[model samples]
Target: MSVQEWSADAATEIVRAHSGVRGALLPVLHALQERFGHLGPEATRLVAKELNLSRADVHGVVTFYSDFRTAPPGRTVIAVCRGEACQSCGSRELERHAQHSLGIGFGETTADGSVTLDQVFCLGNCALSPAVQIDGRLVGRVDADLFDRLVSDAAAR
Candidate 1:
């Protein structure tokens, strides 16, 4: 997870690269998020201006997509599955443990900026219910201890 600091110049370049293209908003947003780890107000403003759209319009899209982040993420992002299958498999307990241990709820980063907790609907691993995606790698049948170990390993990286 190599995230660059957000800068107006860098954002403008990214927005311009996707300007005038069909359905450029998504690509522009992805590029910006990829570079900065998240899209801030300034990035949204530039994107809206360049795309000839209202700031509200851009904001709506950002909010509508779970993949987009409005704030910087921690060095390691931990995503737990919240789909029906996962829930039925004791994922709810797992999620509670995570939140309690991290002292933060979903969509928030730890105070130390080492871990971020998130929830995804599914990871296509229903067979192994209670799946978790840590730093983009999917792990199935996750429990509290496994999650802690994974998070610890991720932080050490």
Candidate 2:
């Protein structure tokens, strides 16, 4: 996608203004993600060029940080906690159920672009293990049916 398509003039201006600062990766990346919801290839290349850094450098940072996204987000973010606590509480099973119900694997957006499924190491909700978060709101004791219900609700909204 083109930068013009995703970024507002304000977002682009932010990128340009900070591109030349030393150790600017984290800040610039945060601003870009805040503006566009995610960082695409075009944005990375633009940032690299503006900052006098290699595209690989930009890409590396993005990939290294799971918080950075290379594609646009869906209307709702469905994050499954993969932390040890959640894992012990059947988080993996819940993850599979969510993926199947959504028809999209982890780190992928639904075809309708309504939801994005992601994996998180922890959500600090271990007591409610096997938890799911939609738009940052935690839902505990997630099962296949519950997962379906959440997706359906998000679609309706």
Candidate 3:
């Protein structure tokens, strides 16, 4: 998803729009991240104030949700499925190739900012083991060469 820079005015607008909802915190956080690519400190603080919650309260929620990111992600995110099906089909090797070649572990973006490598439990494509998701595009039967090519494609873009 495309994201705009964090603006207090813009964040305030987003926050205020959702503050009235029941259990508004999650929705508010999602909207903020959708706009800014992350829930940075200033935005978090703004939300805490608008929701009449403590910064610690908001921060705990942010950090607790795996879906929320506190910092900007790389342009492309590559997720390898390590589900039982995937693991039985050489996903371990594929996972190693991703980590070694990318030189970053799960949840870390490449130094060049072209990609972020992540390990997920499953993509639910067990029929085709060793599944991968590149920027939300599901791919099956991936190998080291294919992974490299995909990364190159993302970098070229």
TM-score per model over all chains: 0.92, 0.80, 0.93
Question: What ranges in model 3 sit over 4 Å off?
Answer: none
The residue-by-residue lDDT of candidate 2 on 10-87, one tens digit each, is 666887788468788899998888777889888888888778889999999999998998888888899988889888
Pairs clashing within candidate 1: none
lDDT of 3 by residue, 1-157 (tens): 4789888998899888885699999999999998898888998799999999999999999999887888889999899998999989899999999999999999999887888888889998999889999988999999999999999998888
lDDT of each: 0.91, 0.83, 0.91
In model 2, the number of clashes is: 0
Best by TM-score: 3
Q: Rank the candidates by lDDT, best first.
A: 1, 3, 2
- Rank all candidate structures by their TM-score, best first, as comma-separated numbers: 3, 1, 2
Clash number for each model: 0, 0, 0
What TM value does model 2 have?
0.80
Instruction: Write down the worst ten-residue block by lDDT for model 1.
Output: 1-10
In Å, residue 131's CA in model 2 sits off its true spot by 1.7
